[model samples]
Target: MLETYCNASGQRVNNEKSSIFFSKGCPQVTRDGIKNTLQVHDEQLSDRYLGMPTDVGQAKNGTFKYLKDRVWEKIK
Candidate 1:
């Protein structure tokens, strides 16, 4: 699927900045197979994306505290 897209679009994925994310329940063997098949590197997702938290946890306040800080800073 990716191959066809890249072929038709004349654009290829930048492997350097590419990563494959798998569910927590996904087995290591399956993850390895999928990564090998996709020819993409396996990397842990960053805690934040575009300056925002990517995964919200039980502690919502902590996850979003940065926004409050930013707001206060801007207000000041």
Candidate 2:
């Protein structure tokens, strides 16, 4: 699958600036396999992009508290 994409695009993807992210419940062993399969480094998902949660998980309860704290800090 990766071979097909790279071949079709004829472009190289920079792994340093690019990454793959797995959901929280993914087992470490599975994560490792997926990362290796993708041939890119794993990276943390940014909580906020332009002052908003980047994904649904980050926007949900408890997790969003961090962003709220940042907002409160600026308002205060």
Candidate 3:
């Protein structure tokens, strides 16, 4: 589950170096083709994509399993 927020306003407002609006919830994982439909909020923001968790461990608990699996596979 990955969450992303965009700043549609393009005001170049510095949200304290934070690009995301708010993403503390689990994001639904769907096929690439269905991703567009799942994005219910099409509201444009000022920035592009930002504020995503770079580390797998930092992700939500529910999404941790998937991240771990990928990491383990890479180690093999």
User: Could you say which candidate leads in lDDT?
Assistant: 1
List the candidate numbers ranked by TM-score, top first: 1, 2, 3
Q: After superposition, how far is residue 56 of candidate 2 from its true place, in Å?
A: 4.0
Find the number of clashing residue pairs for candidate 1: 0
Clashes of 3: 9
**lDDT measured at residue 54 in model 1 versus the true structure, 0 to 100:** 82
Which is better, 1 or 2, measured by lDDT? 1
- Per-residue lDDT tens digits of candidate 2, residues 1-76? 8678889999877777666777889998988887787777656787566777677655387757787888899999
**Clash counts for all predictions:** 0, 0, 9
Candidate closest to the true structure, highest TM-score: 1
At residue 12, candidate 1 shows an lDDT of 93
TM-score, per-candidate, Cα-based: 0.72, 0.54, 0.25
Candidates in order have lDDT scores of 0.86, 0.76, 0.43
lDDT of 3 at 50: 44
Give model 1's TM-score versus the native structure: 0.72
**lDDT at residue 59 of model 1 (Cα atoms):** 93
Residue pairs of candidate 3 with colliding backbone atoms: 7-45, 7-46, 7-47, 8-44, 8-45, 8-46, 9-45, 9-46, 10-46
In candidate 2, how many Å is residue 45 off? 1.1
- Residue-wise lDDT of candidate 3 within 20-74, one digit each (tens)? 2224452544333243444433322342234334443454675456657788999
